[model samples]
Target: MQDTTMAGLWALGLGTVKAQSTVTKTMNASIPTLVVLANLPQLALSVIYVLVNRLLSAMAAAREWASFAHSRKGLRVTVPQGQQRSTLWLQLPYSFAIPQLVLSALLHYFVSQSLFLAQIAIFNARDETEDGGASVSSIGFSAIAIFCSLLTTGAVLVAVVLAGLVVRSEAEDGT
Candidate 1:
């Protein structure tokens, strides 16, 4: 759920930028600034991925602790031995980790596709034009980018729903 919220917040920020660009049509910014702006989504998504991964690890630990507390086997160690030692990444089953990794990749790809800075030269129609033309630059959004972003969000939502179902099933089965 936290991961979903993070994705939603990112989507909201993208939508806000799109709306602003649509209304203004142009934004004055330096090349360096545009470059930084273009990469911001990637940075934000990376942070989100780390936070979500940690959240999943914590959830797995809690689930394991609950099971151990209730088990009739008592204080037997749950941690795996040898090279398959317990760690943050090892806490989650591959079933959960793989989808999360795929979704994170998709999120990064879709976000990179969705927004970018574009510079276009504009010519003046007036005869009294001094410089004859000027360049306008702004962030641009594409329909396909919007579609990709929404698809990624939907995929994340579906993953969350599936995880919930798995947890519920495990509880019912006492496993």
Candidate 2:
């Protein structure tokens, strides 16, 4: 199952690279470098997420077991009183991270586009052109940056969505 998840991640990476490659005929090899730079932080976040989630899940399981044990011993089980306690270890910045992921994506896109446009302006600064219709200044999208940013934003979004689902499942199971 872990292998499957890793494989899916790799596929997602490849797909994003391939999708962005459609924009220009620049160096295709640059994709990997940008991807690595952009994803390093997210990789750390992913590891933290998995570790903390496992810890919380174990605690929840232990609490459930203890309650069951007490009930089997003919003692009444006290409902796990703290609603916030259930999520203590695994609380994500849902209010912030969700919108942050989305906004970061859009911002990254614009930044990348601006860089590409700047590059175009630089190339055209000498008034050089292939078809003579216009200079390279018209290019408006930095393909690599956009791709990398999207990759990162995508990872965060997936994590957030999965976190929401797990929280919901845990709640439902407890009830």
Candidate 3:
């Protein structure tokens, strides 16, 4: 599951690059170097996201097992010694998993939209040629998009904390 999630994120990054290239082509602009530099932080974020996701999945599974054990008096839940029958998705509730998936998608979309390559044509009055002036291309940042991406990131972090808290509370109550 983790590998699949990481692969999806990589595919999303590639798609964003392709989309940016298309936009740049339409505007007759070259991609800025800063765009490549910007990806480093995104890569780091993706790594962090994967790790946090793994942690949250484990917590969710523990919460599920705790609930099961608590519901049945004098019953003990033991961790699997080897291969497990159920996957992480199966352990997580739909209400918890669905929103996490949605938030992750929104986060990626907003992050990709936040930075863009933009071209502006500079026209000169002195030049009478059809193409009077050169075009200036640069990396542009959208404030609103950045803000939204940050908000989505915050939401993911909050979800992790909430999940951890739920697991901790469950463990305490089960004990």
Candidate 4:
């Protein structure tokens, strides 16, 4: 429970930093319009993923700790070398839930940053410089990038939902 709490807090702090960085970069960019528009999809996706992930994390943590309290008499601080067994099923919430949430948060941040950068590149490519910039061939790259990121975020969201379902089933079974 302590570990999961710490991980969740760390994810929250890291996500805030990343969001601020994204906003700062977008504000300072030469193509504010393009950057802002490009960020819209990612921003919506981030909000959805963040909310769902946080809820899953909290629910899993609560259930796991409740199970622990119920089995307190059988609980031990550490498993012996030859007897690596215990009543606590720590892997589900600790290994899967918290890490996935953190990964989603981190991935969302980087993908959003990449989207902003790609838009800036595309906007710059349209300039009338002597050396010239990217041709029309690269114009669709930003859209493709945004689409790919959205797809990946959707897949992760599905996985988180599945984890929540597993937690719910386990609770029902009294496991």
Identify the candidate with maximal lDDT.
1
TM-score of candidate 3 to 2 decimals = 0.60
Candidates in order, TM-scores: namely 0.62, 0.30, 0.60, 0.47
Provide the clashing-pair count of each candidate structure. Answer: 0, 1, 0, 0
For each candidate, the alpha-carbon lDDT, in order, equals 0.66, 0.45, 0.62, 0.53
Whichever of 2 and 4 has more lDDT, that candidate is 4
Top TM-score: which candidate number? 1
Score candidate 4 by TM-score against the native. 0.47
Kindly report the root-mean-square deviation of model 1 from the true structure over all alpha carbons.
9.1
Select the stronger candidate by TM-score from 2 and 3. Answer: 3
- Candidate 2 deviant stretches above 4 angstroms: 1-115, 119-136
Candidate 1: stretches off by over 4 Å? 1-25, 69-90, 121-136
Task: Kindly indicate the candidate among 2 and 3 with the higher lDDT.
Answer: 3
Report clash pairs, candidate 3. none
State the lDDT of candidate 1 residue by residue for 1-175, as single tens digits. Answer: 2233555545545534444333133377776787688778889888878877777776665566656545643332358565443444555877779889889888887788677776656555564434665666677654455677788878887877777677656666668
